[model samples]
Target: MDIEKIAKAIEMDAGERLPDIRESLQEMVDGKAASVHTPEQLMLRTTRQKLGLSQSDFARLIRTPVTTLCDWEQGRFNPPGSLMCLVEIADKRPDVLRDVLM
Candidate 1:
């Protein structure tokens, strides 16, 4: 295999794509680009935010490990249906959840 040739070609390709990459990043920063989030992720994050809690606090309040909560929020894992139902309730009635659960 011609490793050196392959490396050089990759470098050239990256250089050629740099401008487009920068433009895409700029668009994201300018809010011209939209990023997709799954419904579960959105709901979990929204619930936590609505309760005005940080990840660790929210995780503790929900009795889940912070890492697991992070996984759910980042869409790396799907929270169970029961957890989703709780999250929906929390999202809709943050005050109630906080009052009852906290």
Candidate 2:
């Protein structure tokens, strides 16, 4: 990887591009512009962190194989709609899953 190029890009993003990007994303959130992200792009790592679970624990909780969970986290494959729904539910209402599991 070109470390110098990556560093320059990071510097540029922090110094100049971040504000415009943030504004554009805000506009999209406010319905002033179209979204740049899709629901399917919900990152597995973020969801797992929100649920306060490790990959192994989360995979068990979701009743999926750890290998599958790792694949999702690594972006090797996208989870199906049903799994996505479960992930959304776990991210938004973790208590629901916790309650059900008890």
TM-score of candidate 2 on Cα atoms, chains taken together: 0.59
In the range 1-102, model 2's lDDT, one tens digit per residue, is: 454455557668677544355454456567785534444545667888887889899888888899998877766677888988877787888899799863
Could you give me the TM-score of model 1 versus the true structure? 0.63
Worst 10 residues of 2 by lDDT: 17-26
Candidate 2 wrong stretches, greater than 4 Å: 1-42
Please provide TM-scores, in order, for all candidate models, with all chains considered together.
Answer: 0.63, 0.59
Off by over 4 Å in 1: 1-36
In order, candidate lDDTs are 0.81, 0.72
Q: How far in Å is the alpha carbon of 87 misplaced in model 1?
A: 0.8
Q: Residues 1-102, candidate 1, lDDT per residue (tens digit)?
A: 454455556658877534355445556567795666899899889878877899999999989899999999998898999999999888777778878988
